[model samples]
Target: MAIVGGGPAGATLARLLAKDYKVLVIDKRRLDSDPQKGQFTKCCGGLIAPDAQKMLAKMGLALPQNVLVSPQIFAVRTIDINNKLERFYQRFYFNMDREKFDRWLISLLPDEVDLRCGSQFKHFEQEEDAVRIVLTQNNKTHIEHAKILVGADGAHSLVRKQLGIRGLVPREYISVQAKFTAKEIMPYFTAIFDKEITDYYSWIIPKEQHLLLGTALKPRENVSSKFELLQEKMKRYGIKLNKQVEKEGAFILRPMRVRQLSVGQSPIALIGEAGGWISPSSAEGLSYAFRSASYLAQAIKSDFKNYHKHYLDNITPLRRNIRLKNLKAPFMYNSQMRKWVMLSGLQSMQIDEN
Candidate 1:
């Protein structure tokens, strides 16, 4: 089997399945190298949800010190657009380098797993018994045959398009994240919600050396103008934007229909952002990405015929919760009381409770 991504979802799945099957993982970026690690992933920085942490721990995967770039987060500060309501509390959350996290996961793969770093999946041709996969590395083309091809690539995945899997790919938005050099990177995490952006939220996560600021907005919004507003907003917290270091962003997908999970009997599976597993409201995709990869790995090994069933079963509840949150997003943006309710949820995430 060949997996066409080496992100959290793809790498995790490849690692899991490599024990029972011959797996070849392909990625456009070189995972073994680190000169430009973070630049390749283009993630929203490191904010692993509680469920995600539990899942990883259950898998016997402990995060090493080298992967972490910040102290354990004890609290977070959340605010509305106008700065009228600010809520702060000591909760349980942590931060890491997204690319380093990816690198670490990829590095953990057993040597039996064939890791094609810097190799791009050009396309695949489905034969009767197997699929002929095509890839290009260092301008040289190659082909490999595999019974399954998993698309763990992010939104706008080439695998997703080639398979003719449509529906619900419409609700995609742009998430722009940039790095900045600053004197003080806050210990606590900061999240902001603005009606002006209206669809998704923004965040400020502090690494040991840099400040990571990002926003997910509708394609119609002026991305540059939103960055300006974000800068002004950060000033309220005493975070002055310093020399900009680097920037990375991508389109995140939120599927609109169950048909989006419609993968026919073909030897294919779209699991991560490619499968529209991201949150509709928050744009957080990691938890779902990890979970979906696990489920897809199961389907690939045992119930290949029922792949679509497994896919639907895994994502049905997620989509429902996403819809509920999307419904509540506007209220949280428009009403102070509602924003309090939102903050209250975060406030209630006490360490002991967790």
Candidate 2:
């Protein structure tokens, strides 16, 4: 079997099925030895939410101390820009370095699995009994054959596109994040709902010594202008973003419908964001990635020939979770509804004013 991504989903699948099947995992990033050498990092909040923590615990995995960053979050400061409302919500999240976290997961992979770093998946072709995949590395091309192919390559999955399936359309956004040095560490994550900047949302995450400001903006729009405006808004909120250390961006897919999710067909399968399993409300994907990979592993272990059927059946709860999130999205995105909720102080942390 071959997996085209080395993120959480692919890594988990490879690790689980390595002993049984000859698994091969390919990733474009150099995550093996010196991951920092490339200076490439995924644009993410690097937050391990409660659900994701539960998933890790279920897998019998313990997060190493080195993978964790300082200022463990205990609450979320949600700011509604238009309504001029601010509230703190009790939520626990583990803040860590995304690259380091991924590296740690990759390190856990058994020697039985063949891991390839800095290798780009060109494409794949499914024949009678096996699937042939083309990979490029250092301007060289190579082909490999596998009985099963999985695409856990995330939102912009070329493998999913190659399947020629016009899956349900999900709302897409261009996510841009800037890392800035922080004078003082923040104890909580900040969630911004500023319709002026994005109908989606913006966020401020603290990573030890640096603070990350990111927002999801519509594609083909003036993203730079919107991001600048967001920064200005932050300044007005008494939060001044200092000198930017780095900037990154990526495509974000928010699935609003359960039908958007897919585990793929027989020979070809998908997982994680590639299969549209991300949370529509919070855009949380780690839990979905881990859970999907686990289900896929179970299916392969039970009956490899009926992997897709078993996977689809196993992920019914995940799909139902998506539906529940969809039901809650309006209470978040709708300004009037959100305003009422904030005013009601429902589940909001109370801070006494002296």
Candidate 3:
């Protein structure tokens, strides 16, 4: 089996399949002796809900205590256009060091899984029984023949493009994430919502010795300016911009068709954001990525006819509900729809709105 993109999805899948099949995981980034070097510029603010934690624990992985940014987040605050704030108490939440977490996850993979980093994919040619892949690594080009090919290459997936799968219709939403190391503040996860301004929210996640502060907005809007606006908002909320750590941006795809995970092409599958498993509302990819990886692993193991439904089951409902709610937001604005959304998330996730 050939797995492209050795991030969370590819690493997890490679680990799972290595038990039964020979798996090769390839990635473009150089694999340094230092695990932290594998950490790419991820847009996630590193907030993993309890359910996701449970899944990771099942995989014999636990969030390293030292990397734990925040454990007990009991409050969630949402700020509106007029600077009106509604705060709720969250029951549970976890803030983590994304780089550390990813490295930790990748470390769990078995040595039998041929993990190749700094390998660039050239293209692929389909044969009778397998697909022939052309890749370049260490300044040398090579060919990899696999019975199955899995694309976990993320949003701009080269595998998806090579397979002639149309990209998901670009949505109007985009997220800009910035990580900062500063003194902890407020001891909770907070999201400030202002529709009139950005049509999205600002987040403050307090971590160990630092805080992950970010803002997500519609893609059509000027994101650079929006980041400045978010910084000002953070200042208003009493968050001091002390030290800059890292900054990254991502585009969010809404409720759109995922052409990657089709069963039409036998022995080929797509997983993670490359498969369009991101939540349309929150753009949360970790949970969905985990879910998709597990499902795909199972389908590959079992006698499954339609894997698309299994993959869609993890995200379609949430995506549909979010789209419907967004459509009604114009009418529901005065009814505290934004506040309700935040509260509902806290309730469903069993986390306090801080």
Candidate 4:
């Protein structure tokens, strides 16, 4: 078996199947060594939400302290710039360094699995009984064959493209984020909604001595200008970003319908964002990644020949959750509805001014 991508989904699946199968994981980023070796660290809020925490508990995993970042979040301050309305909602998130977190997950992989870092998956070819995986590392090409191939690769997944299972693929957006030196830290996360900027959303997450300000923008649009505008708009709420230390961007998937989700056919399967398991409204993918990977692993273990059927059967709840989130999207994304919710203070909490 071979897995492309070493993110949470791939790593989790590798860990689960390592003991059972001869697994090989190909990841472009060198998490085991210098992550900065010409690799793009994913752009994310790096918050481990309650759902993700629960998944960890179910997996019998406990996060080490080194994975955590400072100013632990306990609330989310949602702001609607158009209505000048803002509300606080109780939420808990473990702020952690994403790269380090991925590295830790990879480190947990058993010795049975073959781990290949800094290796890029070029493409794949399916034969009669086995699949051919082509990878490039250090400008050299390598080919390997596997009976089962899993695509835990995230949005913009090449494996998904190769599957050619055509339906409604999830909508794609470019997420741009900048890390600025933090003069101070906020105790909670910030969610910003401004229709003028984007119908998606924006966010501010503090990571120890650095503050991250990011927004989801329509791809190919003036993303740089929009990001700058987002930074300026944040200043209105007294969230002035300090000198920028770094900037990063990545593609995020938004599944508007359950039909958009594809777990892949036999021989080739997908998990995490590649399978459209990410949340439609919040873009929270960690929980979905862990859950989907777990289901796939369970399916493979239960029945290899019928793994696809079992995988689909196991993900019924996940599909339902996506539908529920789709149903809730309007109340969160629609300006009028969101304004009403904010004005009504629905499900919102009042923070002590003192």
Candidate 5:
């Protein structure tokens, strides 16, 4: 089997399938022994709920205890049109260093799994039963054959385009995120939402040395302008910005149909964000990536049809509902709705009740 893209979804799938299948992971970037290489600019503030942690444990990976910056979610602070504060407190959440987490995950994969870093998937050809993949690494061309191809690539997935699958088109949505090492802010995951400023929310994830501050808006909104607004809010909260560590942004694509998960002639599957497993409303994709990779591994090992049914019946409906609700309530970003939904969901999982 061959997997494209070596992010969380690709790495997780490679590790899961390595035990039974000869897995080869191809990526556009080459893996360096240097730790810095794994520290790519991520838009996420790196807040993972306890339920997500439990899911990771089921996959034989445990969340690092010491990596968390804080665990005190004092309140869900929301700003109204009049700039009033609405606070709701249930429980605390953990903040992590995304770079550290990604590096750790990559290291957990077994040696048997062939990891080809800096190798970009140029294209592919489908035979009767297998796929012949073409890749370019260091200006050198290479070829590999596999019975199944898994695309764990990010939003701009080459695999999705190559398969000619019509799902969520590009430019449908956009989100901007930045990581900074600032003076330690409150040891909490605080979200501020307002419509007039930006049709999205801002987050502050306290870390050991600094805080991860980020803001996101839809494609139609001015992201750079939103970032500026986020900076001003940080200042208003007395959150000192020490230095800009990293900055990155990406388009958020919400697939209109769950069937887009299957995007190939056969023996090929798209997992993670590439598969459109992202939550349309919250734009949260990491947990979905982990879950999709696990499910895809199961299908590849047993029955492919079963994989489709399980994903569709168990997860797709909820995602669809969330998307529909988000479409109907675009004003959710106007107030405390986003934070409320997240807190409510976390509370429902007993993550906050405890």
Candidate 6:
């Protein structure tokens, strides 16, 4: 079997079946080498939720100290722009060195699994018994024939496009993850909500030696100017995000259709953001990516005939809930509704508001 895109989803799927199958995992990243300081993945805040942590531990892939960027966060402070309402939630997320995290996961894969990093998947042609995949490495082209093809490639997935699936309708948001210096990175996360800029929100996530500041813009427009606006808002909260050292921007995959998972027949499957398994509320992909891959691996192990149906049966509710959360975001935010929510016992970290 062949898995394209050696990300969290692909890596997790490979680990699950590698001992039994000769899984070939391909990625453009060089997973074999050690990363220099200040290296991270593109378009990633590198935050993992509690559920994802449990999943990793259960899979026998414990997170090492080298991969952690920050300690477990216990709370998130949220600020609304309209009325300047603020609230604190007990929920939390863990941050990591994105590059190191990916490498660590790659290390957990069975040595028997063929991990071909620095290689790119170009295209594939389906045959009677196996699919022939074209890949390029060191400027040389080669073909890989597999009994099954798994598309774990990300948002701009060539696999999805090749399958003739329609592009993300209503489109997705444009977001940027920027790193800035801080005196000491806090354990807590921050969310700044402003309807003027975006319906989703902006965030300040703590890391080991730096902080990650990011924002998502809806289909309406990009948030370059809004990013400036965020810097100003952050100043009021005593967080100065000046002189951005590094920045990466990309399109966040928003679910245009709830039931969209795989586009091809039995032997082919789509996983991760390629299948639109991204979280609707936060645009978070790791948890869903891992979950989708887990389900897909299970089905493949059971029976290929029941793969699609089994996956759909298991993931239908997950997609539905995300759709509901996306629909509720606009109404749940905004100044008018927030004013009432604050009055209805919402807590705040901002002392002036108290």
TM-score of each: 0.87, 0.97, 0.80, 0.97, 0.80, 0.89
Give candidate 5 regions above 4 Å deviation. 30-32, 37-41, 65-67, 70-76, 80-83, 170-172, 233-239, 242-245, 254-265, 304-354
Who is ahead in lDDT, 2 or 6?
2
Candidate 6 local Cα displacement, residue 244, angstroms:
1.8
Candidate 6 residue-wise lDDT, 1-354, digit = tens? 999988888888898889878899999878767855554455787888876777776676677888876656878877777777677777757678778788887898978999998899999999988999999999999899998898888877888788877544325678877888778756678887787767777888877667788988764664677777777767776886656788888777777456554534557788888777887766778878888888888877777666777776666666776778667655456568667876575554442322
- Per-residue lDDT for 164-209 in model 3, tens only? 6564433435667777777545566776666544655577777666
Candidate 3: segments with Cα more than 4 A from true spot: 30-32, 35-39, 57-60, 70-72, 167-173, 256-264, 304-336, 339-354
Q: By lDDT, rank the candidates, best first.
A: 4, 2, 6, 1, 3, 5
Instruction: State each candidate's clash count.
Output: 0, 0, 15, 0, 3, 0
Predicted candidate 5 versus true structure: per-residue lDDT over 240-342, tens digit per residue: 8777776677666655444444434466678878877766555567777787787767666666544555544445544564457457554455345545555
Predictions: Cα RMSD each: 3.7, 1.3, 4.5, 1.2, 4.8, 2.9
The digit string of per-residue lDDT tens for model 4 on 244-329 reads: 98999999999998999999989899999999899999999999999999999999999999999999999999999999999989
Worst 10 residues of 4 by lDDT: 31-40
Q: lDDT tens string, model 2, 188-306?
A: 89999998999899999999889999999999899999999998989889996899988889988898777777788779999999988899889899999999999999999999898
**Of 1 and 5, the candidate ranking higher by TM-score:** 1
Candidate 6 TM-score over all chains jointly: 0.89
Looking at model 5, which ten-residue stretch has the lowest summed lDDT? Answer: 345-354
In terms of lDDT, the poorest run of 10 residues in model 6 is 345-354
Q: Supply candidate 1's per-residue lDDT for 33.
A: 85
On residues 13-117, what C-alpha lDDT tens digit does candidate 1 reach at each position? Answer: 998898889999999988888846344665666887676787788778888888787756877777666545566666666577777888899989999999999
Off by over 4 Å in 4: none
- Candidate 2 stretches with Cα past 4 Å from truth are 352-354
